[model samples]
Target: MESLHRDDEKRTLRRFLRRQRQALSEHEQRLAAQRLCHQLKALPEIRRAKRISLYLPVNGEIDPTPLIEWLRKRRVEVYLPVLRPFSANVLWFVAYQRDTPMVRNRFNIWEPDMRFSAQRQNRLPAWALDTLIVPLVGYDANANRMGMGGGFYDRSLAFMHRPGPSPNLIGVAHACQQVASLPVEPWDVPLTAVVSDQGYVRRTR
Candidate 1:
Protein backbone atom coordinates (compact mmCIF):
# COMPACT_ATOMS: atom_id res chain seq x y z
CA MET A 1 0.00 0.00 0.00
CA GLU A 2 1.05 3.62 -0.45
CA SER A 3 0.87 4.26 3.32
CA LEU A 4 3.25 1.38 3.98
CA HIS A 5 5.80 2.73 1.56
CA ARG A 6 5.69 6.22 3.07
CA ASP A 7 6.23 4.78 6.50
CA ASP A 8 9.25 2.85 5.25
CA GLU A 9 10.67 5.92 3.59
CA LYS A 10 10.27 7.91 6.78
CA ARG A 11 12.06 5.25 8.77
CA THR A 12 14.98 5.22 6.36
CA LEU A 13 15.22 9.01 6.40
CA ARG A 14 15.09 9.17 10.18
CA ARG A 15 17.91 6.66 10.55
CA PHE A 16 20.11 8.46 8.06
CA LEU A 17 19.53 11.89 9.59
CA ARG A 18 20.05 10.64 13.14
CA ARG A 19 23.38 9.18 12.13
CA GLN A 20 24.41 12.40 10.41
CA ARG A 21 24.02 14.41 13.60
CA GLN A 22 25.47 11.78 15.92
CA ALA A 23 28.59 11.56 13.75
CA LEU A 24 29.59 15.14 14.66
CA SER A 25 32.69 15.56 16.78
CA GLU A 26 32.55 17.03 20.28
CA HIS A 27 34.06 20.26 18.99
CA GLU A 28 31.50 20.46 16.22
CA GLN A 29 28.69 19.86 18.64
CA ARG A 30 29.80 22.71 20.89
CA LEU A 31 30.18 25.07 17.98
CA ALA A 32 26.79 24.13 16.61
CA ALA A 33 25.18 24.70 20.00
CA GLN A 34 26.71 28.15 20.27
CA ARG A 35 25.67 29.13 16.79
CA LEU A 36 22.17 27.80 17.43
CA CYS A 37 21.83 29.99 20.50
CA HIS A 38 22.94 33.04 18.57
CA GLN A 39 20.28 32.46 15.94
CA LEU A 40 17.62 31.86 18.60
CA LYS A 41 18.43 34.96 20.64
CA ALA A 42 18.06 37.13 17.58
CA LEU A 43 14.55 35.91 16.94
CA PRO A 44 11.79 38.21 18.20
CA GLU A 45 9.74 35.30 19.45
CA ILE A 46 12.58 34.31 21.79
CA ARG A 47 13.47 37.84 22.89
CA ARG A 48 9.92 38.80 23.81
CA ALA A 49 8.92 35.56 25.37
CA LYS A 50 8.11 35.69 29.07
CA ARG A 51 7.63 31.94 29.34
CA ILE A 52 9.20 29.32 27.10
CA SER A 53 9.79 25.59 26.98
CA LEU A 54 12.95 23.78 25.80
CA TYR A 55 14.19 20.22 25.86
CA LEU A 56 17.50 18.74 26.97
CA PRO A 57 19.61 17.49 24.10
CA VAL A 58 20.22 13.81 23.51
CA ASN A 59 21.39 11.77 20.53
CA GLY A 60 23.11 14.81 19.06
CA GLU A 61 19.97 16.96 19.12
CA ILE A 62 20.95 20.59 18.83
CA ASP A 63 21.50 22.05 22.32
CA PRO A 64 19.29 24.94 23.45
CA THR A 65 20.57 25.15 27.03
CA PRO A 66 22.97 27.96 26.23
CA LEU A 67 20.00 30.31 25.94
CA ILE A 68 18.86 29.51 29.48
CA GLU A 69 21.24 31.93 31.15
CA TRP A 70 20.37 34.76 28.82
CA LEU A 71 16.68 34.09 29.29
CA ARG A 72 17.09 33.90 33.07
CA LYS A 73 18.97 37.19 33.16
CA ARG A 74 15.96 38.86 31.60
CA ARG A 75 13.60 37.28 34.15
CA VAL A 76 12.21 34.88 31.56
CA GLU A 77 10.69 31.66 32.88
CA VAL A 78 12.30 28.59 31.34
CA TYR A 79 10.65 25.18 31.30
CA LEU A 80 11.76 21.69 30.28
CA PRO A 81 9.61 18.92 28.85
CA VAL A 82 8.97 16.14 31.33
CA LEU A 83 7.41 12.92 30.13
CA ARG A 84 4.00 12.86 31.67
CA PRO A 85 3.47 9.93 34.03
CA PHE A 86 0.74 7.46 33.02
CA SER A 87 0.11 9.50 29.90
CA ALA A 88 0.24 8.17 26.38
CA ASN A 89 3.39 9.63 24.86
CA VAL A 90 2.63 13.15 26.08
CA LEU A 91 4.80 15.77 27.80
CA TRP A 92 4.41 18.19 30.70
CA PHE A 93 6.39 21.42 30.75
CA VAL A 94 8.13 21.73 34.11
CA ALA A 95 10.11 24.62 35.46
CA TYR A 96 13.89 24.16 34.97
CA GLN A 97 16.08 26.12 37.33
CA ARG A 98 19.57 25.85 38.74
CA ASP A 99 18.17 23.74 41.58
CA THR A 100 15.45 21.79 39.80
CA PRO A 101 15.81 18.12 40.67
CA MET A 102 16.62 15.96 37.65
CA VAL A 103 16.28 12.24 36.96
CA ARG A 104 16.47 10.02 33.92
CA ASN A 105 13.16 8.96 32.44
CA ARG A 106 12.43 5.60 30.83
CA PHE A 107 14.02 6.87 27.61
CA ASN A 108 17.26 7.64 29.53
CA ILE A 109 16.66 11.32 28.91
CA TRP A 110 16.97 13.71 31.87
CA GLU A 111 13.89 15.61 32.97
CA PRO A 112 12.56 17.28 36.06
CA ASP A 113 12.16 14.77 38.85
CA MET A 114 8.60 13.64 39.48
CA ARG A 115 8.79 14.85 43.05
CA PHE A 116 9.17 18.39 41.75
CA SER A 117 7.01 18.05 38.67
CA ALA A 118 4.17 16.57 40.72
CA GLN A 119 3.49 19.91 42.30
CA ARG A 120 1.23 21.75 39.86
CA GLN A 121 2.99 25.00 40.79
CA ASN A 122 6.14 23.77 39.07
CA ARG A 123 4.62 23.03 35.70
CA LEU A 124 2.63 24.48 32.82
CA PRO A 125 0.66 23.01 29.96
CA ALA A 126 2.16 23.06 26.47
CA TRP A 127 -0.38 25.61 25.33
CA ALA A 128 0.74 28.10 27.99
CA LEU A 129 4.25 28.54 26.65
CA ASP A 130 5.12 31.65 24.67
CA THR A 131 7.49 29.68 22.50
CA LEU A 132 8.81 26.14 22.47
CA ILE A 133 12.22 25.00 21.23
CA VAL A 134 11.30 21.60 19.81
CA PRO A 135 13.67 18.81 18.83
CA LEU A 136 13.42 16.97 15.52
CA VAL A 137 15.12 14.13 13.65
CA GLY A 138 14.77 15.92 10.33
CA TYR A 139 13.16 18.85 8.56
CA ASP A 140 12.76 20.38 5.11
CA ALA A 141 13.11 23.84 3.48
CA ASN A 142 9.37 24.29 3.94
CA ALA A 143 9.76 23.86 7.73
CA ASN A 144 7.88 20.55 7.77
CA ARG A 145 9.23 18.42 10.64
CA MET A 146 10.01 14.78 11.21
CA GLY A 147 10.19 13.91 14.87
CA MET A 148 11.36 10.67 16.50
CA GLY A 149 8.10 9.06 15.26
CA GLY A 150 6.68 9.02 18.76
CA GLY A 151 3.97 11.61 17.99
CA PHE A 152 4.30 13.03 21.48
CA TYR A 153 4.39 16.66 20.39
CA ASP A 154 1.80 16.13 17.70
CA ARG A 155 -0.61 14.73 20.26
CA SER A 156 0.19 17.39 22.84
CA LEU A 157 -0.34 20.25 20.44
CA ALA A 158 -3.37 18.75 18.79
CA PHE A 159 -5.30 21.62 20.34
CA MET A 160 -3.81 23.79 17.60
CA HIS A 161 -6.02 22.08 15.04
CA ARG A 162 -8.88 24.17 16.38
CA PRO A 163 -9.04 27.95 16.14
CA GLY A 164 -7.59 29.37 19.31
CA PRO A 165 -4.38 30.56 20.92
CA SER A 166 -1.41 28.23 20.60
CA PRO A 167 2.24 28.48 21.44
CA ASN A 168 4.83 29.16 18.77
CA LEU A 169 6.46 25.80 18.10
CA ILE A 170 10.00 26.24 16.81
CA GLY A 171 11.77 23.07 15.71
CA VAL A 172 15.55 22.98 16.12
CA ALA A 173 18.00 20.53 14.59
CA HIS A 174 21.45 20.31 13.03
CA ALA A 175 21.71 21.78 9.53
CA CYS A 176 22.82 18.42 8.18
CA GLN A 177 19.41 17.01 9.00
CA GLN A 178 17.59 19.02 6.31
CA VAL A 179 16.29 16.97 3.41
CA ALA A 180 14.99 18.00 -0.02
CA SER A 181 11.42 17.10 0.93
CA LEU A 182 9.38 15.25 3.53
CA PRO A 183 6.05 13.46 3.56
CA VAL A 184 3.71 15.40 5.80
CA GLU A 185 1.29 13.29 7.76
CA PRO A 186 -2.21 14.26 8.85
CA TRP A 187 -1.26 14.11 12.53
CA ASP A 188 1.82 16.27 12.05
CA VAL A 189 1.70 19.72 13.68
CA PRO A 190 2.92 22.61 11.60
CA LEU A 191 5.85 24.50 13.09
CA THR A 192 6.35 28.25 13.07
CA ALA A 193 9.86 27.71 11.77
CA VAL A 194 12.90 25.44 11.85
CA VAL A 195 16.27 26.83 12.90
CA SER A 196 19.73 25.32 12.61
CA ASP A 197 23.36 26.28 13.25
CA GLN A 198 23.62 27.47 9.67
CA GLY A 199 20.35 29.41 9.35
CA TYR A 200 16.57 29.04 9.52
CA VAL A 201 13.53 28.13 7.44
CA ARG A 202 10.21 29.76 8.18
CA ARG A 203 6.97 28.21 7.05
CA THR A 204 5.09 30.25 4.46
CA ARG A 205 2.41 27.65 3.89
Candidate 2:
Protein backbone atom coordinates (compact mmCIF):
# COMPACT_ATOMS: atom_id res chain seq x y z
CA MET A 1 0.00 0.00 0.00
CA GLU A 2 1.12 3.62 -0.49
CA SER A 3 1.25 4.18 3.27
CA LEU A 4 3.66 1.28 3.70
CA HIS A 5 6.04 2.76 1.10
CA ARG A 6 6.10 6.15 2.82
CA ASP A 7 6.79 4.55 6.18
CA ASP A 8 9.66 2.57 4.69
CA GLU A 9 11.13 5.67 3.13
CA LYS A 10 10.89 7.55 6.42
CA ARG A 11 12.65 4.75 8.31
CA THR A 12 15.52 4.70 5.82
CA LEU A 13 15.92 8.47 5.97
CA ARG A 14 15.86 8.55 9.77
CA ARG A 15 18.61 5.97 10.07
CA PHE A 16 20.84 7.80 7.61
CA LEU A 17 20.42 11.18 9.30
CA ARG A 18 20.93 9.76 12.79
CA ARG A 19 24.18 8.16 11.73
CA GLN A 20 25.32 11.37 10.04
CA ARG A 21 24.94 13.43 13.23
CA GLN A 22 26.41 10.75 15.50
CA ALA A 23 29.54 10.76 13.36
CA LEU A 24 30.42 14.35 14.32
CA SER A 25 33.49 14.69 16.52
CA GLU A 26 33.21 16.20 20.01
CA HIS A 27 35.05 19.29 18.77
CA GLU A 28 32.55 19.69 15.95
CA GLN A 29 29.63 19.11 18.27
CA ARG A 30 30.80 21.70 20.79
CA LEU A 31 31.39 24.33 18.15
CA ALA A 32 28.03 23.58 16.59
CA ALA A 33 26.30 23.93 19.96
CA GLN A 34 27.94 27.30 20.62
CA ARG A 35 26.96 28.61 17.20
CA LEU A 36 23.43 27.36 17.66
CA CYS A 37 22.97 29.09 21.01
CA HIS A 38 24.35 32.33 19.63
CA GLN A 39 21.79 32.27 16.85
CA LEU A 40 18.93 31.34 19.19
CA LYS A 41 19.58 34.28 21.52
CA ALA A 42 18.85 36.65 18.65
CA LEU A 43 15.44 35.23 17.81
CA PRO A 44 12.55 37.39 19.05
CA GLU A 45 10.64 34.29 20.10
CA ILE A 46 13.39 33.33 22.55
CA ARG A 47 14.07 36.87 23.76
CA ARG A 48 10.45 37.57 24.61
CA ALA A 49 9.68 34.20 26.15
CA LYS A 50 8.76 34.19 29.85
CA ARG A 51 8.79 30.39 30.06
CA ILE A 52 10.50 27.97 27.67
CA SER A 53 11.12 24.24 27.38
CA LEU A 54 14.35 22.63 26.14
CA TYR A 55 15.66 19.12 25.76
CA LEU A 56 18.91 17.51 26.88
CA PRO A 57 20.93 16.23 23.95
CA VAL A 58 21.77 12.59 23.35
CA ASN A 59 23.26 10.66 20.41
CA GLY A 60 24.76 13.76 18.81
CA GLU A 61 21.58 15.80 19.00
CA ILE A 62 22.51 19.49 18.98
CA ASP A 63 22.88 20.69 22.58
CA PRO A 64 20.35 23.27 23.74
CA THR A 65 21.39 23.02 27.38
CA PRO A 66 23.95 25.77 26.83
CA LEU A 67 21.14 28.30 26.79
CA ILE A 68 19.96 27.38 30.28
CA GLU A 69 22.42 29.62 32.11
CA TRP A 70 21.72 32.48 29.74
CA LEU A 71 17.98 32.06 30.13
CA ARG A 72 18.18 31.77 33.89
CA LYS A 73 20.22 34.96 34.15
CA ARG A 74 17.39 36.81 32.48
CA ARG A 75 14.96 35.26 35.00
CA VAL A 76 13.20 33.32 32.27
CA GLU A 77 11.70 30.11 33.65
CA VAL A 78 13.38 27.04 32.11
CA TYR A 79 11.78 23.62 31.76
CA LEU A 80 12.83 20.17 30.54
CA PRO A 81 10.72 17.50 28.89
CA VAL A 82 9.78 14.76 31.31
CA LEU A 83 8.28 11.51 30.06
CA ARG A 84 4.83 11.45 31.61
CA PRO A 85 4.36 8.43 33.85
CA PHE A 86 1.77 5.83 32.67
CA SER A 87 1.31 7.68 29.40
CA ALA A 88 2.74 6.16 26.25
CA ASN A 89 4.84 8.59 24.19
CA VAL A 90 3.66 11.65 26.09
CA LEU A 91 5.82 14.43 27.58
CA TRP A 92 5.24 16.96 30.33
CA PHE A 93 7.48 19.99 30.69
CA VAL A 94 8.81 20.14 34.23
CA ALA A 95 10.72 22.99 35.77
CA TYR A 96 14.51 22.58 35.66
CA GLN A 97 16.29 24.35 38.47
CA ARG A 98 19.54 24.01 40.40
CA ASP A 99 17.91 21.55 42.77
CA THR A 100 15.68 19.59 40.37
CA PRO A 101 16.23 15.84 40.87
CA MET A 102 17.32 13.89 37.80
CA VAL A 103 17.04 10.29 36.60
CA ARG A 104 17.33 8.40 33.35
CA ASN A 105 14.24 7.23 31.52
CA ARG A 106 13.93 3.88 29.71
CA PHE A 107 15.52 5.37 26.58
CA ASN A 108 18.53 6.37 28.77
CA ILE A 109 17.64 10.06 28.35
CA TRP A 110 17.87 12.14 31.53
CA GLU A 111 14.76 13.78 32.96
CA PRO A 112 13.38 15.09 36.21
CA ASP A 113 12.53 12.38 38.71
CA MET A 114 8.92 11.19 38.78
CA ARG A 115 8.44 12.35 42.36
CA PHE A 116 9.16 15.91 41.32
CA SER A 117 7.30 15.65 38.03
CA ALA A 118 4.19 14.26 39.77
CA GLN A 119 3.71 17.54 41.59
CA ARG A 120 1.17 19.43 39.50
CA GLN A 121 2.56 22.77 40.63
CA ASN A 122 5.90 22.10 38.92
CA ARG A 123 4.89 21.48 35.33
CA LEU A 124 2.98 22.96 32.42
CA PRO A 125 1.34 21.64 29.27
CA ALA A 126 2.94 22.21 25.88
CA TRP A 127 0.52 24.99 24.96
CA ALA A 128 1.35 27.01 28.06
CA LEU A 129 5.02 27.52 27.25
CA ASP A 130 6.08 30.50 25.21
CA THR A 131 8.70 28.54 23.25
CA LEU A 132 10.15 25.07 22.97
CA ILE A 133 13.49 23.92 21.56
CA VAL A 134 12.79 20.53 20.01
CA PRO A 135 15.19 17.85 18.81
CA LEU A 136 15.11 16.50 15.26
CA VAL A 137 16.47 13.58 13.24
CA GLY A 138 16.12 15.45 9.96
CA TYR A 139 14.54 18.57 8.46
CA ASP A 140 13.92 20.38 5.18
CA ALA A 141 14.18 24.06 4.16
CA ASN A 142 10.53 24.56 4.95
CA ALA A 143 11.21 23.47 8.57
CA ASN A 144 9.41 20.14 8.12
CA ARG A 145 10.90 17.75 10.71
CA MET A 146 11.46 14.03 11.13
CA GLY A 147 11.66 13.11 14.82
CA MET A 148 13.24 9.93 16.30
CA GLY A 149 10.08 8.11 15.10
CA GLY A 150 8.64 7.93 18.63
CA GLY A 151 5.93 10.57 17.93
CA PHE A 152 6.26 11.83 21.52
CA TYR A 153 6.64 15.44 20.39
CA ASP A 154 4.07 15.17 17.65
CA ARG A 155 1.53 13.88 20.15
CA SER A 156 2.40 16.40 22.89
CA LEU A 157 2.13 19.23 20.38
CA ALA A 158 -1.09 17.96 18.78
CA PHE A 159 -2.92 20.85 20.41
CA MET A 160 -1.44 23.06 17.68
CA HIS A 161 -3.86 21.52 15.19
CA ARG A 162 -6.79 23.44 16.70
CA PRO A 163 -7.26 27.19 16.71
CA GLY A 164 -5.86 28.08 20.10
CA PRO A 165 -2.72 29.06 21.98
CA SER A 166 0.10 27.29 20.14
CA PRO A 167 3.64 27.58 21.45
CA ASN A 168 6.52 28.42 19.15
CA LEU A 169 8.22 25.11 18.27
CA ILE A 170 11.86 25.51 17.30
CA GLY A 171 13.51 22.36 15.98
CA VAL A 172 17.26 22.19 16.67
CA ALA A 173 19.82 20.11 14.79
CA HIS A 174 23.24 20.17 13.20
CA ALA A 175 23.49 21.66 9.73
CA CYS A 176 24.34 18.26 8.29
CA GLN A 177 20.87 16.98 9.16
CA GLN A 178 19.15 19.14 6.56
CA VAL A 179 17.88 17.06 3.64
CA ALA A 180 16.49 17.98 0.23
CA SER A 181 12.92 16.95 1.04
CA LEU A 182 10.85 15.00 3.53
CA PRO A 183 7.52 13.15 3.49
CA VAL A 184 5.12 14.99 5.80
CA GLU A 185 2.55 12.94 7.69
CA PRO A 186 -0.96 13.86 8.82
CA TRP A 187 0.01 13.72 12.52
CA ASP A 188 2.99 15.98 11.93
CA VAL A 189 2.83 19.25 13.92
CA PRO A 190 4.80 21.81 11.94
CA LEU A 191 7.56 23.88 13.56
CA THR A 192 7.91 27.65 13.55
CA ALA A 193 11.49 27.21 12.28
CA VAL A 194 14.55 24.94 12.27
CA VAL A 195 17.81 26.41 13.59
CA SER A 196 21.25 24.90 12.95
CA ASP A 197 24.89 25.89 13.43
CA GLN A 198 24.84 27.62 10.06
CA GLY A 199 21.52 29.50 10.34
CA TYR A 200 17.76 29.11 10.54
CA VAL A 201 15.08 27.81 8.16
CA ARG A 202 11.72 29.41 8.87
CA ARG A 203 8.51 27.78 7.66
CA THR A 204 7.18 30.08 4.99
CA ARG A 205 3.94 28.19 4.49
Candidate 3:
Protein backbone atom coordinates (compact mmCIF):
# COMPACT_ATOMS: atom_id res chain seq x y z
CA MET A 1 0.00 0.00 0.00
CA GLU A 2 2.86 2.36 0.74
CA SER A 3 4.44 1.71 -2.63
CA LEU A 4 1.11 2.13 -4.37
CA HIS A 5 0.44 5.39 -2.58
CA ARG A 6 3.84 6.75 -3.51
CA ASP A 7 3.30 5.91 -7.15
CA ASP A 8 -0.12 7.52 -7.18
CA GLU A 9 1.15 10.59 -5.40
CA LYS A 10 4.01 11.01 -7.83
CA ARG A 11 1.77 10.69 -10.84
CA THR A 12 -0.72 13.15 -9.38
CA LEU A 13 1.99 15.63 -8.55
CA ARG A 14 3.51 15.37 -11.99
CA ARG A 15 0.18 15.94 -13.65
CA PHE A 16 -0.75 18.84 -11.42
CA LEU A 17 2.61 20.51 -11.78
CA ARG A 18 2.57 20.10 -15.51
CA ARG A 19 -0.91 21.55 -15.76
CA GLN A 20 0.10 24.42 -13.53
CA ARG A 21 3.08 25.02 -15.75
CA GLN A 22 0.91 24.94 -18.85
CA ALA A 23 -1.92 27.04 -17.44
CA LEU A 24 0.41 29.96 -17.31
CA SER A 25 -0.12 32.03 -20.43
CA GLU A 26 3.19 33.75 -19.99
CA HIS A 27 2.04 36.67 -17.79
CA GLU A 28 -0.39 34.40 -15.93
CA GLN A 29 2.41 32.49 -14.26
CA ARG A 30 3.89 35.71 -13.04
CA LEU A 31 0.52 36.83 -11.78
CA ALA A 32 -0.10 33.50 -10.07
CA ALA A 33 3.22 33.83 -8.31
CA GLN A 34 2.41 37.36 -7.33
CA ARG A 35 -0.96 36.33 -5.95
CA LEU A 36 0.72 33.65 -3.87
CA CYS A 37 3.17 36.22 -2.62
CA HIS A 38 0.45 38.68 -1.74
CA GLN A 39 -1.42 36.10 0.29
CA LEU A 40 1.67 35.14 2.29
CA LYS A 41 2.49 38.76 2.98
CA ALA A 42 0.07 38.85 5.88
CA LEU A 43 1.11 35.61 7.60
CA PRO A 44 2.17 35.93 11.25
CA GLU A 45 5.04 33.47 10.75
CA ILE A 46 6.52 35.43 7.89
CA ARG A 47 6.10 38.52 10.00
CA ARG A 48 7.73 37.08 13.12
CA ALA A 49 10.80 35.07 12.18
CA LYS A 50 14.25 36.51 12.76
CA ARG A 51 16.34 33.67 11.43
CA ILE A 52 14.91 31.75 8.51
CA SER A 53 15.95 29.16 5.93
CA LEU A 54 14.07 28.73 2.67
CA TYR A 55 14.47 26.72 -0.47
CA LEU A 56 15.02 28.95 -3.48
CA PRO A 57 11.95 28.89 -5.71
CA VAL A 58 12.02 27.06 -9.02
CA ASN A 59 9.79 26.78 -12.08
CA GLY A 60 6.09 26.74 -11.22
CA GLU A 61 7.29 26.74 -7.65
CA ILE A 62 5.45 29.08 -5.30
CA ASP A 63 7.55 32.21 -5.32
CA PRO A 64 9.26 33.22 -2.12
CA THR A 65 10.49 36.48 -3.66
CA PRO A 66 8.11 38.61 -1.65
CA LEU A 67 9.01 36.93 1.60
CA ILE A 68 12.69 37.26 0.83
CA GLU A 69 12.23 40.95 0.17
CA TRP A 70 10.34 41.35 3.42
CA LEU A 71 13.05 39.52 5.32
CA ARG A 72 15.74 41.77 3.88
CA LYS A 73 13.87 44.95 4.73
CA ARG A 74 13.33 43.76 8.29
CA ARG A 75 17.02 42.87 8.70
CA VAL A 76 16.20 39.19 9.23
CA GLU A 77 18.99 36.75 8.47
CA VAL A 78 17.77 34.66 5.53
CA TYR A 79 19.36 31.43 4.33
CA LEU A 80 18.88 29.24 1.25
CA PRO A 81 19.52 25.55 0.68
CA VAL A 82 22.06 24.38 -1.83
CA LEU A 83 22.60 20.79 -2.86
CA ARG A 84 26.28 20.08 -2.47
CA PRO A 85 28.55 19.73 -5.39
CA PHE A 86 31.05 16.87 -6.05
CA SER A 87 29.43 13.74 -4.59
CA ALA A 88 27.72 14.85 -1.44
CA ASN A 89 24.07 14.04 -0.73
CA VAL A 90 23.79 16.54 2.08
CA LEU A 91 22.18 19.95 1.94
CA TRP A 92 23.75 23.14 3.25
CA PHE A 93 22.21 26.47 4.13
CA VAL A 94 23.98 29.67 3.07
CA ALA A 95 23.21 33.20 4.04
CA TYR A 96 21.19 34.90 1.32
CA GLN A 97 21.11 38.61 0.58
CA ARG A 98 19.48 40.62 -2.16
CA ASP A 99 22.87 40.92 -3.73
CA THR A 100 23.72 37.24 -3.53
CA PRO A 101 24.59 35.98 -6.98
CA MET A 102 22.80 32.92 -8.36
CA VAL A 103 23.62 30.49 -11.15
CA ARG A 104 21.58 27.64 -12.60
CA ASN A 105 22.15 24.14 -11.34
CA ARG A 106 22.39 21.01 -13.50
CA PHE A 107 18.62 20.68 -13.16
CA ASN A 108 18.24 24.25 -14.49
CA ILE A 109 16.93 25.66 -11.24
CA TRP A 110 18.62 28.81 -9.98
CA GLU A 111 20.75 28.15 -6.91
CA PRO A 112 23.09 30.04 -4.68
CA ASP A 113 26.83 29.86 -5.11
CA MET A 114 28.02 26.29 -4.52
CA ARG A 115 30.99 27.70 -2.66
CA PHE A 116 28.59 29.03 -0.01
CA SER A 117 25.64 26.67 -0.38
CA ALA A 118 23.92 24.98 2.57
CA GLN A 119 26.10 21.87 3.06
CA ARG A 120 29.33 23.75 2.46
CA GLN A 121 28.18 27.08 3.86
CA ASN A 122 28.73 26.70 7.57
CA ARG A 123 28.78 24.29 10.49
CA LEU A 124 26.48 26.20 12.80
CA PRO A 125 24.51 24.14 15.27
CA ALA A 126 20.98 23.26 14.17
CA TRP A 127 19.20 24.84 17.13
CA ALA A 128 20.31 28.28 16.03
CA LEU A 129 17.50 28.73 13.54
CA ASP A 130 14.21 30.30 14.54
CA THR A 131 12.20 29.14 11.54
CA LEU A 132 12.52 27.11 8.37
CA ILE A 133 10.30 27.36 5.26
CA VAL A 134 10.30 24.18 3.22
CA PRO A 135 9.05 23.45 -0.28
CA LEU A 136 7.21 20.24 -1.08
CA VAL A 137 5.67 18.56 -4.08
CA GLY A 138 2.60 17.81 -1.98
CA TYR A 139 1.41 18.19 1.58
CA ASP A 140 -1.71 17.87 3.73
CA ALA A 141 -3.37 19.84 6.52
CA ASN A 142 -2.13 17.17 8.87
CA ALA A 143 1.47 18.23 8.19
CA ASN A 144 2.30 15.14 6.17
CA ARG A 145 4.60 15.91 3.23
CA MET A 146 5.52 14.13 0.04
CA GLY A 147 8.81 15.42 -1.25
CA MET A 148 10.55 14.59 -4.48
CA GLY A 149 11.84 11.31 -2.98
CA GLY A 150 14.86 12.93 -1.33
CA GLY A 151 15.08 12.67 2.44
CA PHE A 152 17.51 15.52 2.94
CA TYR A 153 14.99 17.79 4.64
CA ASP A 154 13.54 14.93 6.66
CA ARG A 155 16.90 13.74 7.98
CA SER A 156 18.09 17.26 8.66
CA LEU A 157 14.90 18.34 10.45
CA ALA A 158 14.76 15.12 12.46
CA PHE A 159 18.32 15.64 13.62
CA MET A 160 17.65 19.25 14.52
CA HIS A 161 14.55 18.37 16.52
CA ARG A 162 16.36 15.81 18.69
CA PRO A 163 16.95 18.06 21.68
CA GLY A 164 16.70 21.75 22.39
CA PRO A 165 17.06 24.67 19.98
CA SER A 166 15.07 23.25 17.11
CA PRO A 167 13.35 25.77 14.87
CA ASN A 168 9.76 25.63 13.68
CA LEU A 169 9.35 23.88 10.35
CA ILE A 170 7.03 25.83 8.08
CA GLY A 171 5.99 24.79 4.61
CA VAL A 172 4.88 26.93 1.69
CA ALA A 173 2.77 25.59 -1.13
CA HIS A 174 -0.08 26.32 -3.53
CA ALA A 175 -3.54 25.37 -2.36
CA CYS A 176 -3.71 22.87 -5.19
CA GLN A 177 -0.82 20.96 -3.69
CA GLN A 178 -2.59 20.24 -0.44
CA VAL A 179 -3.73 16.64 -0.03
CA ALA A 180 -6.25 15.11 2.37
CA SER A 181 -3.78 12.44 3.51
CA LEU A 182 -0.53 10.98 2.39
CA PRO A 183 1.60 7.92 2.96
CA VAL A 184 4.08 8.35 5.78
CA GLU A 185 7.34 6.53 6.00
CA PRO A 186 9.32 6.09 9.21
CA TRP A 187 11.70 8.81 8.05
CA ASP A 188 9.01 11.37 7.26
CA VAL A 189 9.09 14.58 9.28
CA PRO A 190 5.97 16.58 9.95
CA LEU A 191 5.92 20.35 9.59
CA THR A 192 4.76 22.92 12.14
CA ALA A 193 2.54 24.86 9.77
CA VAL A 194 1.79 25.57 6.13
CA VAL A 195 1.01 28.77 4.23
CA SER A 196 -0.74 29.09 0.93
CA ASP A 197 -2.90 31.54 -1.00
CA GLN A 198 -5.77 30.13 1.01
CA GLY A 199 -4.08 31.34 4.19
CA TYR A 200 -2.38 29.35 6.96
CA VAL A 201 -3.08 25.83 8.12
CA ARG A 202 -1.67 25.61 11.65
CA ARG A 203 -1.55 21.77 11.61
CA THR A 204 -2.10 21.38 15.33
CA ARG A 205 -5.23 19.28 14.85
Best by TM-score: 1
The lDDT-based order of candidates, best leading, equals 2, 1, 3
TM-scores for every candidate against the unseen true structure:
0.97, 0.97, 0.80
Give stretches of model 3 more than 4 Å off.
1-18, 85-87, 116-126
Kindly list the per-residue Cα lDDT of model 1 for residues 112-150, writing each as its tens digit.
887752544788889999999999999999999999999
Ranking by TM-score: 1, 2, 3
Go through the candidates in order and give each one's C-alpha lDDT: 0.92, 0.92, 0.69
Off by over 4 Å in 2: 117-120
Each prediction's Cα RMSD? 1.0, 1.2, 3.2
lDDT of 3 at 100: 75
Which candidate comes out best when scored by lDDT? Answer: 2
Residue ranges of candidate 1 with Cα displaced over 4 Å: 117-119
Candidate 2, 1-205: lDDT as tens digits: 9989888989999999999999999999999999999999999999999999999999999998889999999999999998987899999998888888899999999988867524447888898999999999999999999999999999999889999888999999999999998888889999999999999999999
